[model samples]
Target: MVSFLFLDFDGVLHPQYDGEPTPKEVCFCHLPRFEAVMRRYPGVQIVISSTWRQQFGMLQLRAFFSTDIARRIVGITPTYPADGPPRMHIREWEILQWLKQHHASNKQWVALDDSQGDFRDYRHRVVFCQPWEGLSEHRAVQLSKALQGTRL
Candidate 1:
């Protein structure tokens, strides 16, 4: 089965100190560790679940990552309403919508986010990260374990 990783930026990337950042302020603090771990799981593809994707669009958003990581991104989660006010409780809904569109129920998927949000039944697929630490070494290890089809 295909393996998918739903990646969040703010808290999960670095730290969500002052809320949403401008394009220039987006610092990839722990991206090196993230890349080190991801290198071991070449089959896993990333789907941006960050609000950045909703704000910046794919072309600009992909520019945030290094070339190696950028190549692994398959897509971003769909925006709410197709147009209009952004929907609340989007992480869970967007993921399900994307999965349905891709016919990807059988794929192994995981989300790396600081807030639990409304994961609901998909809680088992999450690898909770600390906002202050971003993707720490321990967290990356947990993700690697999950990607290897093992319990973290």
Candidate 2:
């Protein structure tokens, strides 16, 4: 199956650690765990579902990861001008919009996000991550199961 992952960086990868003057890289405490899952599932393609894609653009965003993970990134989610304001959190809308463009009906997909809002009907597809813990072993197990078409 050609599975796709809609990735969120701030919460899913690590905590936002709001206003602490921390460098961006300092927030990523779970790359090894994340990388382990990615290594286990090399077939799954990644789409940038994080707002960081808007801030830094694709190339720079991909630069945040190792070269191997970078190759798995198929694309970034689209932002619509009609959706209004750059800072607005219309992420679920953007992910769905990107899915629409890509003909997603037959695809297996999942979103890793920290927020509980904004999913609507697609709530079943989300695997909630604990922001404070990042991609802990427990959440990684959840992610793996979700990708394997097991119960979320």
Candidate 3:
């Protein structure tokens, strides 16, 4: 069974913005549906796997979920290394590393992100979303179906 749902904040939960974009600056449209889905599936872990860590740090997590349910989140994977240059690749690496550390294979979880490049190996496991679009009813339905074992 899929035990975890890894989320990318900018394109999946919040609108993708370059400058002046903070979690507080963006609105969460599909949060109600997301909460509904979560309520329907207990014990399923949700992890923030976004690059916001590199841009805004850990505070972004609380800021993003400030008005929504926060208890569902289990962990977060930061986008950049503490001492290295900022790179989106770090996010993907961190995700894979996290999965490896937890002994969870690709089939056991899902990654919802905007970038569809380097993650080709796990493409079947990822739910790719457009950069400017946040979560929508279709994506929520897709997530619900995937959680129910229908891959898409």
Candidate 4:
């Protein structure tokens, strides 16, 4: 009865403010806050659902977090074709694809992302993060509560 957490890096891990990019040194600044919440819920496993996965390998991606937290990140979602069918919720589609591949379609899961439109069809399954604030305490608390429920 393991729960899944689809993690996004750019907007959710660090501030990805509009008009300007975040400095590399300032990236992942909110990771500690996110890790703290994950620590409270050890049963929740994470999967990288960020675009960063397209550029970096799994090991490199995991290096962003503390060792303990890194291990909890089991895998990354499958990438979709850029020219595939027209769709508004590509992120949601990718999450479902990952769940299906793992044979965990029935498992409890949620996505942490800044783009609400990406999860329009499954709004209830997403813990929206503000790109300008990243994983603030408020967003972390929401994530904690989402994971607090008993696994189905």
Candidate 5:
């Protein structure tokens, strides 16, 4: 049983950034991909592991996701801490802390993020994504396979 699926909203779910000249929102492309993955794996628990906490509160975040793929999520973790060196760097720490608090070991969790850098010592468990390569069909299939292999 896969205990938790940590998802980064921006690049993985939505596009990497906003305010582009094309005016095409990243989120528009995300919904379909996210829905497809959700349909194939309904038993997995989804958690919001995005770094958008600086701009949106938990309520706003919940509402945003609820409008799109709400049924896929079990719950959102506490908003990422604000007072940190930088917003991007804090998510890894916050994720680790949350896992420890809930007694969810790394083996039972998989973090999908666009940040390609090593996750310090937890590099083995994280699934890194590229900014341009938002969740693809092949990646989703791989994730499903990984989840199945996870030790409950």
Candidate 6:
């Protein structure tokens, strides 16, 4: 069975800060380490759960990663409709919606994000990243361990 990986760009792939960022804190600076871990899990497909998806086309988003990894990005989560009822854990809701829409609700899945509270109800499926450090060495290890423990 294929597994899903819900991905957030800011605060997960790079530093998320209120102040001006240093030159070294460029976007996707930590992607190499993330990609390294993901390489071991070929069965895992990615779904962008980040706000970046609202600004970029699928092809543009995929361009950020290597060709191999980019191809594994199956899709992006749909944003909640403005007229929809109020909801907490919106990101989690979006992921679930995607799963249902794709008829993949039975697939094993995990989300990589820095906003822990956003996935409070589904904490088990989230591998939280540090906002300032993004996918630091520690977060990378955590991701590996999470994947190893997953059904995938």
For every candidate in turn, the CA RMSD to the true structure comes to 2.9, 2.8, 3.6, 2.0, 3.9, 2.3
* Top TM-score model: 4
Residue 61 local lDDT, model 1: 79
Ranked by TM-score, the better of candidates 2 and 4 is 4
Summarize candidate 6's per-residue lDDT along 1-152 as a digit string, tens digits: 33888999888889887555535649789899989999998988999999889999999999999999999999999998999998778999999999999999888788999987687667888898888878999888888877776422
Q: Write the per-residue lDDT of candidate 5 for residues 1-152, one digit (tens) a residue.
A: 66677788666765565534222554636656666665566676777777565566666766755444565565555555456455444556767777777766553677777775525665555666666666776666666666775522
Decide which is better by TM-score, 2 or 3. 2
Clashing residue pairs, backbone N/CA/C < 3 A, model 5: none
lDDT assessment of candidate 1:
0.79
CA lDDT, candidate 3, residue 72: 66
TM-score for candidate 5: 0.71
Q: Candidate 3: global Cα-lDDT?
A: 0.69
Q: Give the lowest summed-lDDT range of ten residues in model 6.
A: 16-25
Give the C-alpha miss distance for residue 59 in model 3, angstroms.
Answer: 7.7
**Model 1 — which ten-residue stretch has the worst lDDT?**
17-26
- For model 2, how does the per-residue alpha-carbon lDDT over 1-152 read when each residue is reduced to its tens digit? 53899998876777756645336666667777787788888989999887688789778988878899999998999976675765434667888788889998568788888776757677888888876656778889998888887864
Off by over 4 Å in 3: 19-25, 54-69, 78-90
- Count of backbone collisions within predicted model 3: 0
Q: Write the per-residue lDDT of candidate 1 for residues 58-125, one digit (tens) a residue.
A: 77877877888789998988766767566555687888888888999677788888777647677778
lDDT of 5 at 119: 56
The pairs that clash in candidate 3 are none
lDDT of each: 0.79, 0.79, 0.69, 0.87, 0.63, 0.87
lDDT string, candidate 4, 4-87, tens digits: 999998888998867477798888899889998899888889999998999999899989899999999999999888778888
Q: What is candidate 6's TM-score against the reference?
A: 0.91
Model 3 Cα lDDT, one tens digit per residue, 28-130? 6655666787677776787778755556644557665634456667677644457876555555677777777677756478777777774756677777777
Q: Estimate each model's TM-score.
A: 0.85, 0.85, 0.75, 0.93, 0.71, 0.91
lDDT of 4 at 18: 76
Q: What's each prediction's clash count?
A: 0, 0, 0, 0, 0, 0
